[model samples]
Target: NYFSKNPVTGKKVDWYTDFYYPLLNQWAERVRMVTSPDKLIFVEPVPNEFCPTSLAEHQPANMVFAPHWYDLNALFAKAFGDFTVNVQGLSRGMFPLKTFYWGHKGARENYTLQIRNIVEKAHDSLGERPVLLGECGVPMDMNKGEAFETGDFKWQARMMDALITALEQSLIGFTLWNYNPANDDERGDDWNGENFSWFSRGRALPPSLLYYEQDAPSLDNGGRILQSIVRPYAAKTAGIPIHFQYEMNTGTFTYTWVNSTPNPASQTYLKGEKSVFKPPRTGHPALMSLETELFLPSQLAHGRTVIVKGLDPGDKHRYDESRQTLFIVCQDASLDKVHSIVVSLDPPLAPAFAVNDFWGDFGGTITSILVAIAAIVTYFFLL
Candidate 1:
């Protein structure tokens, strides 16, 4: 039996019941006393644990369930393959036999299921409080540092894409593990041989630069797996966001949200009283004036077309190329109505060259060169 001496009562007590639980509650209470009540308190789960269900009894009003998740198989193996294990299930003693998933599609589905489970558990125990994925990222030094030697981070990009895609499918917010300027190819992050930093000082020539020479890294560049990291996302939504997905191969981004608001009497509405969208019956002009803003990366938005559906006739959309933002106003009279916006490349070419090449040229012909130059000039003029 787990036992501990209660410092306050000078008596022996059950470790988890009389000691650990009280200690955690007291610590949370103490933290709540000092910090502003309006500020969010991100309570981290115990290491290796999935959810903090123990705190359900004394959960603070501003408490947020923040948990860190990682693909243990990939993290430890330092190589991404077609197979993945159910590490979380094994940790929880759910099954004696470890579950395995095969193929890239299966692995990705497994990853997304893991995140979905975490979010669902938090919701079940915490009652609709925000669940923020505290940390999620892939190690850059995969395949025994193959990318470092060849400067081909395509594998790293794929791994990162898988991780982020899981997060996106779960419809949760996350903070990437790290961005360290001091990271290099040799020692990595300078801690326990761990190398997860997005940016690294060690310069390696990528395949794009193999044909050209450059003395310094471009101002827009520095990351290891940027193709997966630098992506389009909805910065702010006037209505409740339902779902969003980005196709890395096709340069297509789709976002959907419902034109609804929380009950006016709800705490969420009171917290953001000034910014909350009022119903049209309330005679609030801002009711139908709210606009959703989406951040579109230059590489994706340069020549893409924006299509918005389920919007009122007067409601419109605009693209600010300078800011790389797509703004859409949806004035649907029905609060239950859902609106969607899709941004896709104009030509809708094959994924292979459409996403990677700017001018969409594979041959080294003079005509291709001229087309590339004209595309560059047009891109600049639009900018």
Candidate 2:
């Protein structure tokens, strides 16, 4: 009866009556016969007007209207809960063609709004069945340049955003549009002539860098190896030195000793397992004692510490670095220990040590004389 009046394949018949039911039957039958361990079928009613209009016009012969997707989700609990729902297909047309097929804003908006309206209808019809934007992407290659918005990368991003946004506000899963890479895929092309799919032997261009840069998922590389560390020296005290030790999980780090009090000589262990040490650099509290060192292979796997030592008064220190792993030792005036140790993989500084700053101060004869005199006095007195 239905076919005599409406030819199944004819352009005159509504696609929903002529094609939709046949396709739905095939899908349901396959799901039933495949009979895999975890395979099953759960059908629901979703209405859309723009597509063939068979289901849209008939209204499933039993269902009524309801709220949009987001409002339906609110029933589960506030804040649009998560869910997975199946979307049939675009109301009309195929992949690349669909993107450009609609000529006016009203048509495009109407199509998009139909999807939004269906989300609400489904929520109301089935009482919110885990809404997901099952499918709403397109396969774009280099050929259909005219079909795309100026064939520009930004257009792809915008299209993706629009398609994604059209789904339920609380959508969970989103399967991209038809992806058949074997059809002569071209990164910038629009069709199958040059591999119409995304995958290819050469570099595959994505919709756009801006899309991933803004919305793609990201991961943390374990928050840099080290956090923060400090080492202080005694101000007016007699022989008290300070040291520190840091515990870290990353591969590298920087060691620093903030020596407000001055020391004649302060030693930082270039390499050490545990305990204390004293070296030759000294400065005030604000001045820091720093050492940037890489961990030996044996020491890299687990945890370790570095020691800082105050050979004599007048030593201020701090240290830092941006490496995979590090162990630092600085003398602490507060502790009786000879040195302090911090283990990490953080950078000691931002600008890093410039050659000009590291060696520029070693000026002339006056500097040499001062160093020599200071060395002599420190050796005689501290010894």
Candidate 3:
């Protein structure tokens, strides 16, 4: 379908090789001519197309391979199931039946494998450039808009979690599909019956109060599937990141990275800071003193315990409450050693007493007091 007839020779020509690739190279050149060297150019892949080796020949410096992926079954059916298709291998003439996944675990594994495959292919074809998942998200109005009527977005949350977990496992950055203020339940994004926005004007309220007007103001507004969207991540690292994962059910987050010595050349001039510094000795590995920062959401960190491993003695970790950031001063003796940080919910000391339990106990105490007062009043009246 992508083959084009050569106008001069009246013969079929490979569109990607003869036309699309040249156009892409020319476009990149034009962009580089106008933009600064530091500005990164994101090259998008053609639909179902991998990063062709031809592109690597003309690959520009500071360029990123940005591709989009989605669960085609969920996108088209407006629902999520235990099955998913292997959309990545389709371009390679791989059989879809051979790539299909069946159970819940299989579906989740498929997402991870697909994303990892993209990253690997990008490295192979485009060198060591960063591969960003340009777009990824789920349709909010899945299952015939049942979540909108019930005010329960568990399905949406699960789908979003699975997608993000895959991205984390693949260790690639991503910009979620959308965040449109004009999105409503009925019209969606106002395009093609699609609803991918994280924020929606239409409230996901129960059917009983779907149209009910409120006299007083409400604090809860907008934001859908926030539990999955708002998550903890390594905002900045002093070294190379090895791996990171978050368990939504357990509110556990773990991140590991190799400790790296601070580069004096990269430091900016600040008040009262040294302008010149001596380089580290060549014979020994330089000790890392830079801080590795992680963005830990306060909501998740409220009752969680943070554990830092591979830190030198006397080196301490700090959590800035206002910024919701966990900073670790990694001073590992060896640069080859990996440092790890874990934040997990603390185990309960006793049986858990939830908000419902508190309310139930309060109600029971009030009822007992009222009965005692009534009995005393009756005794006085009889006397």
Candidate 4:
């Protein structure tokens, strides 16, 4: 609509020939005189000066750049510069923020270009330090005054994909705006109902959607789903590092180590010495270190290694949902056996297979059984 203009008919052609060309030539000349070929310089403030707590909380990621608030920009004009703090809006939520479904309207494209320019200038001024365009997303819903639009789901995602692609070159990372979908209203209508969450209200996650939440396990009790172990059969040599990670589908469990025999098989079997380990509470991954000597059983003549894992019980609903896998690099040739150690990787509680294979096998078996029963019942009734 904004692109519309009158058709070039007889009178209009004359007007264009006279007025438009001369005006365009004059504007071009003026632009050339004012604008330089050199790029604009943009300086970014040091990261922590804006929000001390947030900077402390955000973990290091390979591909992302987090930005400070608008006011903090002046502090970091020079590299490694210290800043005077001006704190605002730091504590608990002051009531709730209104959800405005301001749809993308006039000048949206122009606005995007303006933001792009700012990012470019900032990167040029700061010298490249993983310069990413952070915080530039419209809500799914908006108020009347806000120039944002709520389009179909596919379209929004597609548009975001395009924007992210454009940003990829200069930006090392991107942080999507506030993830908390709760705008303080149960109905969601107060905030246009659309800007809240990736999830829809009411419908609990279906079984089919479980996979996305399963892969990353939480070290703490909010716990992750117990991902199934598709391949049960595993082999381990002695002692490189016994790698094991757990998922708390049914809350967290304490890990205990036992050694049954003296050989490889015995290493898998926690037969005699019982040792339980309660892993520390952590949101981020923490390396575990437990040092103790093991008793070697003579029958197999090999030594035994031990490991333990534990999770808190409070996080049951989501934590108790999955399985854990233990892997070892085989440090000791004398000890080859690795079993599901209340903490071992071998001899998992359920059968273990590759993720894809496990899914296929589980689905196929269920389908086949149902079909067989249906056919048998039909034949009997017909007879």
Clashing pairs in 1: none
Worst 10 residues of 1 by lDDT: 275-284
Every model's TM-score: 0.73, 0.29, 0.74, 0.24
In model 3, the runs with Cα more than 4 Å from the true position are: 1-3, 32-34, 89-103, 204-220, 260-289, 303-312, 347-383
**Model 1 ranges with Cα > 4 A deviation:** 1-35, 90-98, 204-217, 264-289, 303-313, 347-383
lDDT string, candidate 2, 1-383, tens digits: 55445545444654455565666556656665666423443333342232222444433322333222221111122211112111223334435333332212222233355465554444443432334444444333322443234423322322333343343122223444444433322343344332223323233334343234322222111111111111111222223222322122232322233333354355443423211223223333432333323332322332333333433354343332222223333334352234333333233222211212212433576689999999999999998
Q: Against the hidden true structure, what lDDT does model 2 obtain?
A: 0.33
The order of the candidates by TM-score, greatest first, is: 3, 1, 2, 4
Better model by lDDT, 2 or 4?
2
Per-residue lDDT tens digits for candidate 4, residues 116-153, read 44444443333223444445443333233121232233
Report, for all candidates in order, the number of backbone clashes: 0, 81, 0, 59
Best to worst by lDDT, what's the order?
3, 1, 2, 4
* C-alpha lDDT of residue 167 in model 2: 36
Model 1: lDDT to the true structure = 0.69
Q: Looking at model 3, report the run of 10 residues with the lowest lDDT sum.
A: 274-283
- CA displacement after TM-score superposition, residue 6 of candidate 3 (Å): 1.3
Task: Pick the winner on TM-score between candidates 1 and 4.
Answer: 1
